[model samples]
Target: MKKTAFIFPGQGSQYIGMGKDFYDTYACSKEMIDLAGKVSGIDMYHLLFEENQELDITKYTQIAMLADELAVLKAVEEKGFSSTVNAGLSLGEYAALVASGVMTPEDAFKIVVKRGAYMQEAVPTGGAMTAVMGLDNETIEKICQETEGIVSVANYNCPGQTVITGEEGAVSAAADALKAAGAKRCVPLKVSGPFHSDMLKEAGLKLEKELEQVEIHDIQTPYITNVTADYVTNKNEIRGLLKDQISSSVRWQQTIERMIDDGVEVFIEIGPKKSLCGFMKKINKEVSAYHVDKIEDLDVLVKELSGQE
Candidate 1:
């Protein structure tokens, strides 16, 4: 029996026409998309299937990304293949929560609508994020801590790639420091805001209010949280971690490492792109990684998983 992990990707992975294949193939996919539209009060079909600049905006990006991922996830489950554990990055966490049965997709959909809006509203002006490659987490953290402003590590993406976020000035200063500390390159990211940084604390607080309105059920499958990079078995920890996730570093590398350690032999990424699969390669090369973004990808996945059985 091979233990598998169903991983989901976050914001940057979304694109127009992302889940059209699944939507056309599975009734459950269409139902979930419609449900997301109803809960978020946004026309998910147009938002996802048509060309629009709104898909890139934070307020709309969050829910749209999750809806696509969930559509694919439901389709995968329909094939009778499941995961031993699950996890997702940032916005993708909501999809993982739905997969884990901690909350209904309807509840997550509604909350994600607010979550996106609140995060967009809280995006501080003049904030910036940069990817510092070829630097260890300890050195990056040291530079951020020693720097003069709100700068800090945002994502520990993989072994050598770390993202730092904060005030534009502080981030720039940290980039200089990281470069001087033998970093390979410090490239600025063109994100709408400095996500997963302390600057978003107010946004996290606002999201906490929205989270209170949702009902959290018992966990059916365990999942690792980006906030702690560890498995969360107890459903009680879900709410607080979600709130904190807005203002905390995304420990993605650690989360994947933990899953690999816990016997996740295969990682099936159910989403629009192979972003998580790319990360998996940098994190660990031994585990088999697959992604389902198109109808053709589903065929390969079914054959592989069914053969495993």
Candidate 2:
């Protein structure tokens, strides 16, 4: 038997006009997007397609990504394919929860809208994130420790790659130190806030209050959490972990490792980009991975999975 895991992408994978093709082709996709707009009170189609590029605020970006991922998942579900396990990075985790029936799509949209808003408001403007390549986790941690100000490792993305986030000056200093310590590159990311750091504690607390209002249930399929890098089956535990995730590093590498150890021989990334697929290849070359993003990719995926291609 082929064991498969369904993984979703995080914030950075989002692009303009994602899922429009699906929306045009599938009624379910359109319905999902409509629900997203109704719950979040933002024009999903406009924000995703017609809005100016400069309007890609964190809140809108978060909602758009969630809608796209959910749209793709609905299309895949209609194909009668399911997974042994599901996992997502950061905001993507909400999509994972929805797919696993832990929460309704409407509820997930509302939570993510507030989650993104809180995260943006937590940090002042000009807060940034940077990716430090060609450095191990230990070296990155050392640099963050050595830096004077408020920089911290935010995402343990993969081996030889970690992202640091905080105040601009502190992040710059950390980048310099990482380079001095033999880093290949430290590239700043275009983002609105210092996500996944202690700087987000205020946002996390606010999100916790909102989370308490939402009802969470046990997942139909085991969902790996980004905070603990482990599978969470308990409803209450899921709520707590999601709150913690707002201010903790995204343990993506560990999550992928645990999924492989749990017998996930094939990984399917269902979202706007092949970001998770690339990460999976870096973590374990032996594991087969595929991405279904565009309508063509979806058709190809359907054929491949059905053994007709």
Candidate 3:
């Protein structure tokens, strides 16, 4: 079998009825959802499947997205699929950890419950995120540095796409500067907080305490870390990396490149959105990228991975 990497997306990917197909089609999917609710003390089914106001909220969105991703993951594994490596963007990291055997389902659920709540609670008002298109990371970094306040690049998503985050005024100022410096367009994102910015450092500290409670197991399958954009072979680094991830720029582009260098020929994003797959195309078009959001997508992915006769 060719080398495969299982990637999961983070927040902003969740929507109503995301994993309903998997929930209905696979018993393991339902069991994972049930376990998520039991562990998190939230109604996972209603939060995800039903039309509700809580799904978008960060605290709830984290667990909801993780549940959906894991539901689909369960079904994929049952289909006799496994990965050589794993990675996830931001909140999706927990799902990756579970898939890599670094964390059990129960432990991951427990951490996410706290992770989501901490992020939600730490979302300071007057903070914002903006997507800077057609601008190089260095230019964006320079503009953010020149601009006042705590503004910085939040996500290095692709070659020309990077997200900036900071105090509302600072982010706006930086966005304007970026556009003036030849950026295609600086679009203000509908985000609740300055995620991946220094403003959330407190949340990271809180998560560090929470991490101390969970057991970081040996890597059955090595997974990459968002903080450093490299494979995490040392189990000891898990806690610090996960804690710092909340306030660090997500080096998504670098992470994907690292995987490709390490022989990840196929990347299967198992989650609600094809966001990561979209990024993969921008990062490198030669390799194959697939997303198993629905049962039908899984069929296509299975065929692609198993190869054609």
What lDDT would each prediction earn against the true structure? 0.91, 0.88, 0.92
lDDT assessment of candidate 1: 0.91
lDDT of 2 at 157: 86
lDDT of prediction 2: 0.88
Clashing pairs in 3: none
Model 1, which residues run further than 4 Å from truth? none
Supply the global lDDT for candidate 3.
Answer: 0.92
The prediction achieving the highest lDDT against the true structure is 3
Per-prediction tally of clashes:
0, 0, 0
Model 1 lDDT per residue over 250-281, tens place: 99999999989888899999998898888889
Q: Candidate 3, residues 1-309: lDDT per residue as tens digits?
A: 879999999999899999998999899999999999999989988998899999888999999888999999999999889999999999989999999999989889999999888988999999999999998898899989999899999999989899999999999999888889999999999988999999999999999998899999999998999999988888998999999999999999999999999888989999997999999989999888989999999888767667742
Candidate 3 to truth, TM = 0.98
Please say which candidate is ahead in lDDT: 1 or 2. Answer: 1
Whichever of 2 and 3 has more lDDT, that candidate is: 3
